[model samples]
Target: MADYRLHTIFYILTSLLSLAVLHWTVHKVLLSISRSKFKKANNCQPIPKYPNKDPIFGYDYWHALNKAAESRTLLSWLREQYRLYGNTYYARLQTANVISTCDPENLKAMHSTKFKDFAIDSRRKFAFLPLLGAHSVLLANGAAWEHKRAMLKPSFSRSQYTNLPLFERHVGHLIEAVRVENTKKGQVDLAEFFLCLTVDITSELMYGTSIELLTNGNKDLVRDMTQSAEGGHARWLLVFLANIIGNSTFSKSVSKVRNFMKRFVDEAISYRQHSESRSISAKPTARNFEGQQGTEPLDVKGRVIYLQQLSLGTRDRKAILDELTTILFAGRDTTAALLTNLFFVLAHRSDIYDKLRAEISVLDGERPTFEQLKGFNYLQSCLNEALRLYPVIPINTRMAVVDTTLPVGGGPKGQSPIFVSAGTNIAFHVTALHRRKDLWGEDAEDFLPERWEKIQGQGAWMYQPFGGGPRNCPGQHLSLAEAAYTVLRIVQEFSMITGRDSEPWTELIALTCTNANGAKVTLTEA
Candidate 1:
C-alpha cells in the first residue's frame, strides 16, 4: 500500500515537471519573437498603417482588389505602401513582426552578390520542406548545392541534352498528350493537359520512368506538394516560436524528404551498379549523356555559355531523387501554367492565332527541329510576352544578408534608398515589378507580343520573367524550348476559342500561380 502511494506521487510530480518545462519553453519563445519584432520596428522608419492586409500574400502587407489573385495580379497593396512611405516602409504583420523592403537595387543586392548571408526561409521545414527533401539540389545550401549544380550541368547543356532528338521526342509527347485529351471536346482544360505533358516528359527523361501520371491522372507527389504549400502546420505559424524550433522542423522535413527520395534513387543506383558490373573494364563512357562530352562549349544563339565543369555521374541516389523532385515541381507546374496562359490568350485573337499558324506552317512542313524551334522568332516573342504578363513564380523572397541600401522608385535622397538591416524579410514581389507601369511602358497592361521588339530599350533587370543575374534559372532554355515546342504543337493541332464569359482570375496560394477555372478553352481540330 505504501509503495503504490509513493509511485502515484512520483508520477504526479513528473507530470508537473514536464508541464513546467513546456511552459518555460513557450514563454521564452514568445519573448524572443517579441524582442525581435520590437528591434525591427525600432530600426525601421514608420509608414501609414493599412488595416486587414492579406496574410496569404506576404503577411497582410497588401489588400485584395475584389478578384485580384492573392499573390499574382495587380498592384499589391504593396504599391499603396510604396506610395505612402516612399519605398522602404514598415508594417507590423505579426504581434511583434515587421515585414518590409521594395527596391530594385535592394532586390539585386539581397538576391545576388551578398546572397550568402541571407538564407532561404529555412522555416519551410513544415510547409515546403518535403518539397525537395534534403537531396534536392535547389534546396541545398552549402557543399551539397555546389555538388548538385556540378552533377546536373551536363543534362541541360547546349551541346549535350539540348539536342534535336530529345527536344522533338519530348515535344511530340506533349502534342500527343494534348490530342488525346482534346478529341472533339466541347471545352478542354488546357491547364490539365499541359500539366500531364510536363509531368510525363520530365519523369521519363529525369527518372527513366513514365510514372504513368498522365494515364492514371493522379500522383501523390504533385498533390502532396500543393497541399502542403496551401496549408501546412510548420509553415503556418512561426512568429511566436524560437528560430531553433522553426529551423529544426525545416531541417527535419528536408531530412524526411531526403529519406523519401532514397527509394527512387536506390532503384536507379542499383540499375546503374548492375549495368556497370556487366560492362567492360575500359570504356569511353555511356551514350546516355551523349554529345555533351569533350565538345567545345559554344554560345548557342547568344545565351550565356559556360564550361560543363561538373559531371553528374557521381551523384548519390538521394541527390538524384531530390533534383528530380525539384525539377518536377519547378518544371512541370511552371511550363503548364505558361502554356495555359498562352492558349488562353491565343484563343481570343484569331489574328494572332492566324499569324502563329502561318509561322508554324513554314517549319518546312514538319515538326520544328530544335534549330528550327530556335529560329521561330515570332513564337518565342509571343511566349516571352506571356511570361512577362504573368510569371509562373509570381514572387521571390530573400533575407537581408547585410546592412544595405535599396534604390526604390522615389524616397529619401531623391529615390527610396532603403537602409536594410541584416535578417529583415524581403518580398521581391516580382508580380509588382513585372506590372510596374513605369518600367514596362504606356501599354504595359495590354497583352501585346510586340512588347519584346521594344523591350530592348527597357532595362534587363527590369524584365525578369525568367529572373536575372547569376542565380537565374539554369533551365530557362529548357523551359522556353519546351513551352515553345508545346505551344507550336498546340497551334499545329487545334485552335482554342473563348469558351466562357465568366471572368478569369489567377489563384495564388503558396508558390505556384494556377488558373482558378482550369484555363477552359473550346478546342477545334486544325
Candidate 2:
C-alpha cells in the first residue's frame, strides 16, 4: 500500500511540472509571433544597439551613466553618445529594454502623435509618490491625470498669472535681500536669492500669503523641500534598488514638507467651508484692464488666491493638497533655475547684458505691465536662448503602454520607423536635442540670442524648453513672465553686473537644473 501511494504522488508531481513548462512555452511562442507581425505590419527596422560590455545586464553602460552623473558631466556625456551612436539607440538594463533618443521626429511621435501609446511608468511614479502624493497630476496617468489636469487648469489661467501686483510685494523683499547681501559680502549669490524669491512668490499664490523666506530668513521649509526633491531624484536614478533600500532621511523630509503644506491646505478648506456657509460665491469676476478682458476671484483683501480657486473645484482635502504641492514644486524651481542660468551667462557676457538692458530701457524705470513685458522682443529672445541652453528640466522619459513604432530612429541613416515593445523605457534628452547642430546650425552649442531674431520660430519639436504636447508645463507662461519681470527689476537696480567667480557654469541637477557655482556676481548700484 505504501509503495502504491509513493508512485501515485510522483506521477502527480511530474504531471504538474510538465503542464507548467507547456504553458510557458506556448506563451513565449504566441508573444514572438505577435511581435513579428507587429514589426512587419509597421515596417520596423532594427535600431543601433549600445555596445555594452556586459551584454546580459548592460552593467557597464549603467556604471558609466552613474559615473557621469556623479562627476556632473551627465549632460555632456549624453550629448557625446548621440554623436557616437545615431540619434536613437537601444540598451539593456537588467530585465528592461531602454531606448535613448535626441531625435525630434521620435520625440514628437512619443509626446504627441502617439501619446496614448505611452505612460509615465511605475518606476517614475513610485519615485515621486512619496513627495507629490499618489493623486498628484505629475504622477497620475489616464483618467486620473485628466481629472487632476482639469481641476488645476482654472487656477493657472491668464488672469491669475498676469496680476503683476501679486508678485511685486515679493519682488520688493527680494530686492532688499540682495541689497543687504551685496553691502555685506561685496558680492551676491543671485541663485540663492532667486530660489528664495520664487519660493515666496509661489507660497503667496498658493495660500494668499507668503512664506517670506527672503525677509524672515526661515529656511527650514526650503531645506526640507530640497532634501525631499534630491531624494526623489536619487530614487529615480537608482530605480531598480529604490524599492529595496529604505531611505529614512527621504521619509523624514517628505513628512516635514507634507506637514508644512497641510497647514495651508487645512486653512484653505476651512475658509472655503466658511465662505460656503455664508453663501459667498467663489466664481471669478471679469475685469477690463488696459483694454484687455480677464477674470479672477479675489480674496477678502482683494488678492488673487490660487488655493481659494482650487478649493472651488473640489472640497476633497487630499486632492487639493496634492495639486498644490505639485504646483508649488514646479512653480518654485522652474523660474528660479531659468533666472539663475540666464544671470550666470549674463554675468559672464557683458555684451549680452548691455543688449538686454537696452531692450528693457524702454520701460524707463517704470514697473513693466504684462503687455509691456510681452512687447520686449530682445528680452524674450534672451529668455528663449537661456532655456534652450539650460532647460530647467533637462531630461525627461516616457514608457510604452502598448507595442508601437517611433516614426524615426531606425535603419542606417535613422529615417525608418522602429518597433517599441510595451514596457520599454524611452529617455529623450532635451539638453542634447537643443544642441543638435543639424537643427540649430553650427552655433548650436553657443549662447547666441541673435539666432532667435533671425528664426521665425523654434519649429515645434526642435526647441522644447518647457516640453510639448498634452503634458507640457502649464506654468510656463507664468514662469517666463516672472523671470522677465525679475530680470528687468534687477537690471534696473544695477548699472553693471559682472561674474565674481571665474569658473564656468556647472550643473546642480536635481528635480531641475541650475548653476552649481551659484550666480555669484558683483553689482554696481544704478
lDDT of 1 by residue, 1-526 (tens): 9999999999999999999999999998997786567545534333333454543334443224323433344335555555565544555444322344445565665556556755555444334545565655555564556545544554565643355555466566655665665665556677776777777666655555555555666655455544544433334344334344545434454455446546656665664565456642222322212233322122233221211111124335544565656766676778778887777777667778888888888764477677888788789889888877777776565555555444443234434334455666555666666676777778877888877765673356666667555456767787788788777776787744554426554545444565656667666776
> What tens-digit string does per-residue lDDT give for candidate 2 at 213-311?
998887787788888988998887778687688888899999998888888788778877877788664554332111223234476755556777666
Q: Compare the candidates by lDDT and give the number of the best one.
A: 2
Root-mean-square deviation (CA) per prediction: 9.0, 4.4
CA lDDT, candidate 2, residue 447: 95
TM-score: model 2 vs. ground truth? 0.94
Candidates' C-alpha lDDT: 0.58, 0.84
Q: Clashes in model 2: which pairs? A: none
Best by TM-score: 2
Question: Residue 362's C-alpha lDDT in candidate 1?
Answer: 79
